[model samples]
Target: MQHKTIADTMNLTIDFNDIDDGQFADVIEKIRAERRALLKATQEKYAKSRAQKALIEQQKQRLRVQLQCLYGAVVLIMLSLGWVFSNLEGTTPSLDEPGITHRTIEMTRDHRLDGIQLSQVERYFTAKFLVGDWRFRGANVEGNGITIHIEMPQPLSLEPHYQREYIRNSLCPKGDSELWLSVEPANLTIHLYSDHPSRGQSALCAS
Candidate 1:
């Protein structure tokens, strides 16, 4: 069967042979008017559908932007939390040691002295005690540095045993007696251990 417009259907249903020429023309014009109305209705429907699709697309784009911003903020918060926890975990608290303690050299590798010679150091002590007419000799230098073996003319309080500590503890380089000294006495001979060398002519101890 062939497709027919409203004009063709109406012409087939009406008895045009019985109608006058003027009436036939009037019926044809009425069919043409219906065709124009149908075309306009179809165009209006298409325009409404196109506008709906554009509105939907705009809404979808706004939703995508909102999701992107939410994701970025969540990522930033996670990074900030990680950094705070890491710093908290790595931190340590400190405690103090009790007493009025002096600083000590724990590592002896660099204990060797370059500022002064052992011979020059000996002369400093020898000349210092000459007022007491106490004789001084270099005798020997201990294995490394910071110690010397000396012989005096008298016992100089070299009593039996531990009493030597009292004398040594009280000793220091001449002008700076607050500096530490230790003595090992055997008769008139004493082994003086210090942070060694001295002030004045010797550059070891402070002035």
Candidate 2:
């Protein structure tokens, strides 16, 4: 009876050992699930870091584009100012014939004189007088050459009457009519004259 009892106890111990193996399998499965969760968390962290890096790179690219635009604008402004200054420097006046010639003559107006002596430059001798900025009543040929009758806006004594003419030609140089009047008035009278009309002296003026 003692030997039978010993055998039964040994069989019961083997059965318990088999049940413990199944419990160990469940623990191993749980451990595997935890490892998978850890791996997913790590992957998510790496993805977030990569996204941040890409965003930072995009910002840098935008800043670079803006900087390039500002540099281009500065260069363009500098070039434009240089061009304007160069043009201004080239327009300075120099010593040359008809560079800007002004000749004023004195004339005593009298009815016995019958004509006013008009002086002209060689370039304007045969040229038609385009009534530029000169204030004049009438112009015609008198005794010697072309005559320009000047009229003042206010009745002022004759310091001297000036006859003005501007010659227009293809090779005509650029000039301002500033020499004609010191101060510009509201109303002015002007007349056109050409010496080719009368070869001989007329009752007006000689050319």
Candidate 3:
């Protein structure tokens, strides 16, 4: 009876509970592995996208800087051009005034000497004076036995040579004539009555 009971119990039930447990464990492991792989792939994609975005932002910043630099350069150039044009416009002369001017001269002689020879007088004048618009308005001179008065158009001042070559050349030659002047800023009315006809023929004064 005991042997029979054992056989019957063994044969009575063959439960599939163990197989169910093994199958459940395998499914859980597979799900976990898939989750890990998916997470890794997502991380890689996110990192790549972040790097690309950073590069694009850097390029944008560089372009912005270049554009700003170009704009600044253009502004500076325009300012320089404007200044040049303004100076050029201001330097031109007007048309209302005359181009040339002239003057007259008066002469005198000493009274203490009588019967003065017409050729016995000898004199010289020297000056470095500022120039004016009219002749005697700005000039300087000194000498014995002669007096002079004259009107002029330019100042007695010396003009710049290299810069104003055309104007400097236009003035009468100096240093060669005995009665010449380095123009100044004054008007002296005097007499110049020379007894010497030979001296009268020479250059008495110039502007």
Candidate 4:
């Protein structure tokens, strides 16, 4: 019984050796096609994974660029605001300090006065009065005279008599021209009248 079983097993093993060439060729082609299909699928999967990673990296780079731009813009805006506030602080005077009163006065220059005379008059006031919180308010030119307004803070007082003498000695010197100065404390108005034979012009006074 053992010898018969061995003979049957040998026959089954040798049966594959009798396969025809056409059948073997077909089997080999089928296996090659399956392997090609599997290789193609693996290649496609790897390519897709790589593309997704590239897209994700691109998105991260774009986000980083946008964040950098936003930070730079924020810094520029902050610097601009700081500059504006600093300029405002420097130009605007504080009102909390005592004896800091706002006052306005007008100084008129006769059109007949030459540039030298005009400069002298300007220099005299700028040197003596335009100091210690005193500032030029504004100026206007009308008709034959130029009017200038000035503001003085607390502790700075413009005495009319002293200013008259100073102007006469400093500006008119040897000339027969007279400098008339009048002050109205209630209205904060100062009228400057220049009486010269060459120029008989009037300075319109307003506060």
Model 1 lDDT per residue over 88-207, tens place: 432111122111012212211222231123334445566666676443434223233333333334443444344355334432354443222222111112453222212101112222
Q: Higher TM-score: candidate 1 or 3?
A: 1
Per-model TM-score, in order, reads: 0.37, 0.34, 0.33, 0.37
Q: Using TM-score, give the best candidate's number.
A: 4
In the range 28-146, model 4's lDDT, one tens digit per residue, is 56556666777899999999999999999999999999999999999999999988863443222223322222421112222223222333334444565555665543233223343
Model 1 stretches astray by more than 4 angstroms: 1-15, 91-207
Please say which candidate is ahead in lDDT: 3 or 4.
4
Highest lDDT against the true fold, candidate: 1
Question: What lDDT tens digits, residue by residue, belong to model 3 across residues 1-33?
Answer: 112233343466533364466565654465566
By summed lDDT, which 10 consecutive residues of candidate 1 come out lowest? 91-100
**Candidate with the larger lDDT of 2 and 4:** 4
Ranking by TM-score: 4, 1, 2, 3
Error of 2 at 74 (Å): 0.9
**Global Cα lDDT for candidate 3:** 0.37
How many residue pairs of model 4 clash at the backbone? Answer: 0
Runs in model 2 with CA error above 4 Å?
Answer: 1-22, 91-207
CA-lDDT, candidates in order: 0.45, 0.37, 0.37, 0.43
The pairs that clash in candidate 2 are 141-205, 142-204, 142-205, 142-206, 143-205, 143-206, 144-206, 144-207, 145-206, 145-207
